[model samples]
Target: MWHISEYDIDKAVIKLRHENADFRRRLKHEMLLPTDIENIICMASFGIIHLELQPQIIKCKKQ
Candidate 1:
């Protein structure tokens, strides 16, 4: 299980903001930018997807 800290989230948000700016700059016309809510959803989705793809390990104890 991954333990995400506030610092990690902040870093991700910064990276995402930079990407968004680049995309916006490339567009000839203005478009609606992602809202804060959308960003939060994206972060949550990333975490869930990552967890789903990660390998599960099972532990057994011999009695």
Candidate 2:
């Protein structure tokens, strides 16, 4: 299973906001499985941060 953190999401969002070239490239290079991706989306939808978010970033690859 993969893990994703709020900080990771925050960083990703930040990179998105700033248009960070490297981060954007990285996010696009790898994607997470459906289960893990859904978990992160669900947490974000509810405005809750899961414990796992700190250790991993949401994968950019296809499910």
Best by TM-score: 1
Q: For residues 1-63, could you state the per-residue lDDT of candidate 1 as single tens digits?
A: 555567766666566667776534523233323443245335745655332222332232345
lDDT of 2 by residue, 1-63 (tens): 545567766754554536655544554566443444444455554545444445455555355
Model 2 ranges with Cα > 4 A deviation: 20-63
The worst-scoring run of ten residues by lDDT in candidate 1 lies at 51-60
After superposition, the stretches of candidate 1 with alpha carbons farther than 4 Å from their true spots are 22-63
Ten residues in sequence with the least summed lDDT for candidate 2: 31-40
Query: What clash pairs does model 2 have?
Result: 4-53, 5-53, 5-54, 30-60, 30-61, 31-60, 31-61
- Model 2 residue 47 CA deviation in Å: 24
